[model samples]
Target: MKNLILSTAALALTAGIAMADTVRMGTEGAYPPYNFINDAGEIDGFEREVGDELCKRANLECEWVKNDWDSIIPNLVSGNYDTIIAGMSITDERDEVIDFTQNYFPPAASAYVGASADVDVTTGVVAAQTATIQAGHVAESGATLVEFATPEETIAAVRNGEADAVFADKDFLVPIVEESAGELVFVGDDVPLGGGIGLGIRESDGELRGKFDEAITSMKADGSLNELIIKWFGEGVPTYNADGSVVTN
Candidate 1:
């Protein structure tokens, strides 16, 4: 939470000014490529870069707040931060409670990975990070869902035989599977999920959301957003056209 030195009455007088001057960006610092604590104990990753750039473009001073994934949304609602720039997908369910900027990322797939390609994901035990879209999908897909509070724990469950497979964002799983050295392999078809990742904000902060929305629009129009996407996620990932539509192979 941000600290303001004003008395209650004074704060009420300048609430909008305070909201515009300094913004707190919240994220699950455990999710890599989106966010993670570096060896130096500071936040680093794709979202870090994007958030900083967006803040610069929007002419806002911003600081990052690390929070556990399971409680990220609740904290946002309780005013722990001014915005959620985590790799949060734009979903109707979440939108009911908060507003989202236009997507900065193209739609991505959720994938299943197991010890082998033959492992059944349809009816077998599946691990997913709690409070994620993937977990909800697993629960409704007839797979026995075992949820963990963190993404690392979900992967650990699969490794320790607690789960037959782990389902999560394909971008997150790709590097893990590669480094697993054959211990883990992709299984089942990729499932497209959500409406792409966007900045999450309180519904009441429409002005703040609009600032970010315009900044994102500028990035997409100038192709810098696509450059950052390729820089972090590598080639072959979907990118945006000049007109802001997705360019997929």
Candidate 2:
């Protein structure tokens, strides 16, 4: 019987079936207000809070695993972690490789930050984190796209004049722009991208996906999720209705 059980496990592995005993949560611990390392060197951010609540509601024992943004998806597929709770937007292209839970974050805009407000974001050299939706948008927008491995590097590119502007999520840029103390300013019209941020799971983990989906749905129904959204992204951001529909102010 033990041998039969081992054979079944091997078959599951060969079939790319993923099952988790601890539900390891993967994140890019560099994007603030999504997931980032705190001063204590622990993952702390909006996604961290949300992931913990989701795991609790789903009755799952979960732990976070930090990973580089560029390799996050591949690592999840390789079984380095069970789910990606990073600030990953849901897109059809990514959906082909991994399943996503219903969006926890509302559809947000991407903005450009530059040394000056008059910087031409449409045709100028723009920096974006590699493999992000922002990078793809820049590539197709006639802008010279400079891709960086991390979000911090994208901003640094703008500061050092390697790029005219850095395009990134508005929520991630707000605090940065505010703290720039008149050094950095927003340029160009905000571009709406992606379907909103969701938890990424392997396509083979249907049951695990359902568990998170149900947990997210319950949070939406109870208004706790919206509270958390406002707490992190601030008010006036789009929120969720009881039915899981986005309610924009």
Residue 35 displacement (Å), model 1: 0.9
| Tens-place lDDT digits, model 1, residues 108-150 | 8889999989988989999988778788888899989998888
The CA lDDT at 35 in model 1 is: 85
Tens digits of per-residue lDDT for model 2, 1-249: 000001011112223424555789998898888888999999998999999999999988879899987777777878888888888888877776778998998888889999999988889999988878788788898999998888899889988989999989888999999999998999978888888888988878889999999999999999999999899888899999999999988
What range of 10 consecutive residues in model 2 has the weakest lDDT sum?
Answer: 1-10
Model 1 misplaced regions, further than 4 Å: 1-18
